[model samples]
Target: MRVQLKHPARLALALAFGFITASAAAAQEPTPEPQPAPAPAPEPAPAPEEPAPQDPAPEKCEVVIDAAGVPINAEPVTVKASFSRDIGQPARAQVASESGVRVLSAEPDAETPLTFTLTLDTSAGNAGDWAIALEGEGGACEGTISVLPASAPPSR
Candidate 1:
């Protein structure tokens, strides 16, 4: 025997069946392929470059005699000289004395505030004025040194 349903129940059943049919139909249809995400907008071009700042020109190299004219004897005499710029190499100090004063050693100091030392052999030289000449790669200085005569010994 056929079963009889109430009008409300029949209506509810028909709606449920319709929804299920629609869902099945949607599932059977082919889905569109996902598109790649849009490429990120290109970065703005970099700003134009500016020229770098330049350094000031270097000062002309020079040498100056700070002090001289020390008394000469068997001992060594020291003369001090300064350079406006680094000599980069040791300078040559030449001592020319009318009485034959000779330069025993000439050497530049190690660090900045550049300086030189000149040791003179006064034993061979007589009492007179000595010409001091300092020559370097970039500069030179000229000066004079004086030597005093040996004092006479007291009579016994």
Candidate 2:
């Protein structure tokens, strides 16, 4: 079929058709969806704990030399010492000599004074100064002992 129309009328009709097609397509299309909010930031982890500090060791006991008995012949020498702190019952005593003096016996006098007997080894040349030590639950102590020459006479 053939239809005749003027140039201006053809242009107007074409423009109207294009406008109607664009409006129908826009109405039929679906609307865009909204986006969800971002997740909350995670909390930081806690720090580790440190250990507590320790205390220092206690000080050693004090000992004072009161008197020392004479060393005569082959007999043992006696030493008396006073303790600064009270050592409980069943205290321990020891002797250390520079010239080979040996401890023969030791005893604690109730509380304060501690007595010890040191045997002079004439064969090993134990005729000089010696050191005595005493220890117990309370604390510890140290003292000294002196011996005369073998040729010297006993004078205590």
C-alpha lDDT of all candidate models, in order: 0.70, 0.59
Tell me each candidate's TM-score.
Answer: 0.46, 0.44
lDDT, residue 153, candidate 1: 67
Alpha-carbon RMSD of each model: 14.2, 13.1
lDDT computed for candidate 2: 0.59
Residue 91 deviation, candidate 2, in Å? 5.0
> Can you tell me which runs of candidate 1 are displaced by over 4 Å?
1-68, 83-88, 110-112, 153-156
Q: Write the residue-wise lDDT of candidate 1 on 61-87 in tens digits.
A: 555555534554667766666766665
In the range 1-106, model 2's lDDT, one tens digit per residue, is 9776669888898999999999999989998888899999998887787677687666665655554433534655555566566555426665464555555555
